[model samples]
Target: MSLEVKNLVKKYGDKTVVNDLSFTMDKPGVYALLGTNGAGKTTSIRSILGMLAFESGEILWNGGKLDTSKINVGYLAEERGLYPKYTLMDQLLYFAKLKGVSKEEAKKRIKDWAEKLQVTEYIYPPAVKGKKAKVKKAEELSKGNQQKIQLMAALISDPELLVLDEPLSGLDPVNADLFKNIIKEEVAKGKYIIMSSHQMATIEEFCEDLTIIDKGNVVLQGNLNEIKKSYGRVNLCVKVEGDIENLIKEADLTVVNKTPNEYQLKVNKEEDAKVLLEKILQTNLPLIKFELREPTLHEIFVEKVGNVHEE
Candidate 1:
């Protein structure tokens, strides 16, 4: 199945928050919607999921208008959506039932997900010898654990289409890795996922295609690798036992960053990097590291957004 958002436009009275945003997921895999805070990423996602009204645009699923009521879809919102006073188990069951999952099936799925998310104790507290077991309430859990429960609620239905907004935002490192593994498993199961996160490394690891917006405007959209390739391998990183400040100036390379142990430089072309490499070797100062590679997603994001502001 394919998901397409075409020329999506959302405005609040006089200001447009998402302007002509468009992207397509032709097959099952992760598609990233990225932007800075208030850059319209969340608005675009809400419009696509039919959670918010849009002034203009068509969100199509499998070549037809997307109707959440008729299709199975899961969403993990950036803002936590849990009843602070409600028991976690009850909330999960309620969410699952809303998605038409049978009580027995919902409980089974909840059990499995609770185990996978490492929140079993909250959902199914160990029974005290003489007391009734009590399920934990949303407010009782830490933010990270609450995030896991929200994810569990999203996955309870095993939705064909999943939308995750900053899925790892408040997660600890261990839980973050757990979430990543679950995402990988979903991809392996051929699930269609649309993820929006500020984590460029995570996006680069999972998404093959992405759309980056800046102030409601589409700035960059395409296959991630192709985007990086278009920019070319202009990034150069080197480390040596001794200083190479003069060598860098000699090669006419722009230093992006420099520390006592390493130097991050920018070269206009591959040959410029080669010139720097030759200079370092000639010094015979124990070249520790010399690598030239494509600009990372973080760098690309900054450059694109920075350019937009400048324009």
Candidate 2:
């Protein structure tokens, strides 16, 4: 299913959370929605899910108007909601039932997901310990495990679109990879996903398309690589002491940004870096590192929203 949000506006008294925001997402790939906290990412997701009312705008699924009755979507919020005392299986099955899956079907899917996540061992009580045969509580598991369950729950219904907010928050390296791999599998099965995350590394690695909002407005939106290229600069990482600072001070390039040990410099459109390289070598400084590449999603985020405070 394709989603189109046209001139969406959401206000809270004198404050605006979403300000005439608009974007389109089609099926078959992952799209990342990136922004700092309180930038209206959550508010937009709730509007899509029909959980809140907006002052003005149109939300359409496919070519028609978007309505809950016309499509089913799965959402994983940043703050995941789960009953702490409910066993994983029981809780998942209950949710499955709400989605119209039969009890037997829900049980089977739960088993399959448990096996995929390698959490089958925790599904049942320990017979040797004579632990009462009851479902383990959600809080009983680690935060990573809870995140995994939340992801599984979002995918269990096999909805057309999966909305995941900070889906990788609590995962360690291994499990984060596992979760991403699962998302890839789902994409292969033709599921479209909209993921909101603060982890730029993950977004750059996984998302092909993205939209960035700042101060309740979109500052950048498009294909991930395309947007990065648009930031367009021959990025050089340098680690020399003397004269390096002076080179930055009197260079024909725009210093995109800098750190104590390194800096990002943006030259004019397609400006040749050969001149910059020659100048660096002549600086009587031993260069520890230097490379030319485009800015990343993270860099773009900081550049676009560095000083934009919430109104």
Best by TM-score: 1
lDDT score of residue 67 within candidate 1: 90
Q: Tens-digit lDDT track for model 1 on 191-300?
A: 99999999999999999999999999999999999999999999999999998999998888899999997999999999999888888888889998889999999999
Clashing residue pairs for model 2: none
Q: How well is each residue in 150-239 modelled by candidate 2, as lDDT tens digits?
A: 877877777888888998887889998998898888788888788999999989877898888876788778898888777776566666
TM-score of each: 0.98, 0.89
> How much lDDT does candidate 1 score?
0.94
Model 2 regions more than 4 Å off: 129-134, 240-243, 250-261, 269-272, 282-286, 307-311
Note the residue pairs that clash in candidate 1.
none
* Model 1, position 248: C-alpha lDDT score: 90
Q: Candidate 1 deviates by what RMSD?
A: 0.9
Where's the lowest-lDDT run of ten residues in candidate 2?
A: 267-276
Off by over 4 Å in 1: none
